[model samples]
Target chain A: MRRHERHEMTEEARQELAAVDAAISGEAANGEHAPLQELVRALRGVRPQPSGEFLAALDARAARGFRRAGQEHARDSSRGGTARAGVARGATQKPRRRALLALPALGLAVAVVLLAILLPGTGGPGPQPRATNAPSKAVFGAAQAGPAVAPDRAALQPAPAPTAGPSAPGEQARQVERTSTLDVGVAPGNVQATAQRVFTLVNAFSGYVRQSNVNSGPSGQGGATFDVRLPSSNLAAAIASLSHLGHVRSENDTTNDVTEQVSSLQRSVGDQRAQRASLLRQLSQANDPQRAAALKAELNAVEARISQREGQLRALRTRVDYTRLALAVTPEVTAGASTGDLTPSAAAHDAGKILSAALAVLVIAAAAVLPIAAVAIAGWSAVSLTRRRLREQALDAS
Target chain B: MTLVAPRQLATPQQRLERLYAESREDLYAYLASLLGDRTLAEDVTALAFERAFRRRRLFNPRRGSERAWLFGIARNAALDELRRRGRSAALAGDLAAEESSREDHLEGVLRRTMVQVALGVLSARERELIALKFHAELSNPEIARVLGVSESNAGTMLHRAITKLRKACDAQA
Candidate 1:
């Protein structure tokens, strides 16, 4: 609606101005704008004129195309020129130089920022996204089997992620069931060698591979996985050694403490055993046939309880004695796998990693820049708006 | 089919020169009315042209016409001069006194005096509105562009100034 009013007013103003022009030139007139025409003619008569000398000088300057104005002003300024000359030079030169420098400056800033993000070993960490769905648990301390262990836990921590369970103070001899999963990659030919190395590595740690399914299929696109058990004390060392056999794609080592359960079962077995001994004694002391039969039945029941509790204790002990590892060895040709092991899936995975890295960098850069740019633009707009308002107010104030 | 020829474009300097030639007289008139001092108006006019020439390439035709752009610069310069002076355009009794003395035609002197009195009745902004409309020969939209105002507001202000001037002129007569 305001736009419509503006258009209407503009049309009226245009016609009024045309009528004023006609009135002044004595070509035509409009009846409605008689006063406006009279006023315009009076304004033209009262308008000021430049002296011939001033007009001639300005005309000559224009003929020269304003080219010599700068040189003349520069020379004048060197000789302590007029304030106008100095202002003119500053007005023209400063903004042009700034415009010329703007693009490279912005480009340099973005380049520096991207380099800070992308370059390795400049104290910037790689995008290490968590690539697993492991159960989230309390951040546990190191395997506190005691300070008597010899291997350097810190050095072994570089590969094969170790998920430690909390070991409270003075909780010694914990019956923990350790479990780990490892996804390792090897050269195609090394699948067999790497698998053999894995078994030998386990054996060296006094562990055994209980279930093995090693397949380098016809296309050689297959992998090997092992269900193995190692001594709880040697679990970390075994994982570290296994990781050295190939590119450790992913690894998770988790531990479960079942010491209290084991202790409860042991107590139950002891109680049952004592009950059995007492039942037999009562059986021997029985004077009547019915009494002897009842004592014998009680003895049998005690024996059954003892046997059940003992079986539970044994199974728990087996878990405490060894740690289970699920190790999957996928064929990795580019990492020295035989030519047959190369698969489009592997190449695509690599390409995906590169793409993900690029995307992460771009995201980080955008995250860093967009907010500042938005603030700058907003601030600039606010200042421009305020400045314009203030300039218009100057007219009112005058 | 008629053959069409590619139009040659003028260089920026050439264009600036053309605008200077066309608008210099009226621009000076507008500045003189706006400032009410001949010497200051001259200096401001020169300065405005210099600034326009320096910043000619900065002009975007899509935003406004060349004349509007030039007048906008002049308006800013004249306004700055006003702000610096911290007073209204010194349109005191002496300017009218001097004008009446310059003319020998008695009837012309009387008419100019009446017009001068009518103009003097306007406020500074109203006087600028009139100067932009008549002396600068700017259309209302051009006035709006120069003054950084909406077209409707410029039209309303122009109408009000014209009405006030008419009343003042009638009373003077």
Candidate 2:
């Protein structure tokens, strides 16, 4: 039927039908339409009812259904509790997983830092002496070349010894030039004595005091500064001895390898000498005075070049054989001294150093973690988006 | 069975059990009228009750009485079974056997057979309306809610359905 026509029955007609329906069901109705009432009566009388056996079966089935529903409710409640507990466990484990993932990165960073600290030739810029321990062709060649090339070079080479086996690259000794600075605090009365003791120790180690300066204040607070050079073999023992003279405030040690530099210098010296020898031979054979003079002057220039290279090589060898030590001795303040004696600038300097170190660590850690976090977030988003799209497609199919 | 308790406060399940006891016979009759097979009616009635019991938590007393809600479920169940069987024409074989097996008076049996045959002449929707009206005994407004239509529309449709059944019965006579 059309939408508008379905409900077109008048109120009066509806009331008549309702009355007929009431009469058919045995309720009080206006006494009209006897035949229509009879038909409704017959229809109502024939209404079907279930047999007794069917009713018994229905009751049994309904009871079972109720029992099943109750069991499902119990199971759901238990599952809910288990899910909550699992969520709690997962929350606690999340950070531990992050820590576990971070372990290798952290280890890598620590290894980089320790390598920078412990390896030679990887320190701040400073005056680097020659390295005595490394094998150098210059030192060996200088030993054969004699005193005319360099007066000090012969003393720097080791005595000739019998060989055991051909040296491998891995077994080659690194030519490291060691330098250190020490700051020590001593009793005001002991400052002069400490300087004398350091001087004596250097001399005993076949070392020499390069410079020494002592100053005393009007209140008898005195300090001394010493610049010394010591044989490399005695460097550690001298430093230990100096440390006992006072409370050692601070120390810094650095090493520089100069094996390649010495080798290059020796090669240059050899080339210059060959050039000088050729010039001298050309000068001796020249008959013309101008040509002879030119050859002689050129020979002079080559000889001077050779001498200059030999001098440089000699200096490098001496430096490689010795270690430099810069020591500062200051009057110590007693524990009972006034607070005014403390230096605020020094304390602030130390604090700044600590802050910078902490900042460096944070930057390194961030560099390691940020990339991994970004990749993980991107992967999770992609998977989630794909899952949502697939779910939408499945719903559309259904 | 005595389904009504005169004096007691009852839980929701208890209330549902009482409704089930009170309405099971009528609901079975409604299903039989709608589906036209005694066995199918019993099966559909049980399925409808099981569904009602499962979804009882969603029931609101203010919506309609338990009887209307149950009949609505039974109506859907009967239609689903009919659709599954691919037989929307009418009850034929089992209904004939049931009528022949009846020990009642011959006139009463003939009247029932005529009524069943008249019901077959109506469309499925018309037959459902007639069953809800006479067998389930739901009011116009309750039937409207169960069928998801306006009360006036439910009454009009039911009236038209009854007129069709009356015409079919007269022709058979």
Return the top candidate by DockQ. Answer: 1
TM-score of the second chain, each candidate in turn, equals 0.89, 0.85
Backbone clashes (count) for model 1 = 5
**Model 1 Cα shift for residue B124 (angstroms):** 1.9
**Residues A152-200 of candidate 1: C-alpha lDDT, one tens digit per residue:** 3343332332344223235455777778898877665556656665665
TM-score of the first chain alone, every candidate:
0.53, 0.43
Q: Which runs in model 1 stand beyond 4 Å of their true positions?
A: A1-18, A24-26, A30-36, A51-182, A186-190, A196-215, A218-221, A225-248, A251-327, A332-356, B1-8, B37-40, B84-87, B91-104
Fraction of true contacts reproduced, model 1?
A: 0.38
Provide the TM-score for each candidate, comma-separated: 0.60, 0.42
Best by lDDT: 1
Q: Model 2, range A113-166, lDDT digits (tens) per residue?
A: 775566443342211223333223433233222222332343333322212111
| Whole-model lDDT per candidate | 0.68, 0.64
